[model samples]
Target: MKLVAKREGLLMMGFKGFTHFILVTDSQEAMMMLKSEMDWRSNVGNFVEDVRLLIIERTVTDVVFQPRSGNGIAHTLAQFGLMEGTHFFWEDVAPPWL
Candidate 1:
């Protein structure tokens, strides 16, 4: 959604010198929603070119695929977001399995 994008953009701006930001997604719909908004010559061009631009700017952000089991933390974060979506800043809250 636009809200997630805005939050990501803001987070990217706030970070001191993070070289990369990865967005892990399990759902096709969520991936499509994100891919659609990525800037490219065409509306739907797989977003590689746009991603390359970000890398050139010294910030490498990309959407990555992960199996449901492998993406537990992201899933948990989304669930937490649903309950407390307005919290923009997160601290070091380790997961149970950690």
Candidate 2:
């Protein structure tokens, strides 16, 4: 949850709001955690419907995928965040040590 927050913060630093976002994860809990913090009334709805509508509206689509070995960066960053017990925003580049 904290890692997602940090990622969102990083995105906000680049632009106030993204036109589109897609999140995929193995854990429903992670998805729920993120949606819980969102503007439920305006932005979120039935997940599939929202995604389809966004596509129809010509909004950009940002996808988040959780595929064990495939999602190295997110996994690495998330693990790092958990280990450090700190939230850090990453921009164009990941942290040097990472």
The 10 consecutive residues of candidate 1 with the worst lDDT sum are 43-52
The runs of at least 3 residues in candidate 1 whose Cα sits more than 4 Å from the true structure, single-residue gaps closed, are 2-16, 29-58, 95-98
Expressed as tens digits, the lDDT of each residue in 22-49 for candidate 2 is 5456455544544453544532334434
Error of 2 at 87 (Å): 0.8
Candidate 2 structure, TM-score to reference: 0.47
Candidate 1 to truth, TM: 0.48
List all candidate RMSDs to the true structure.
6.0, 7.1
lDDT string, candidate 1, 1-98, tens digits? 42353345435644656555665567565456455545545543334444334444644476555676887766676667567765443556664544
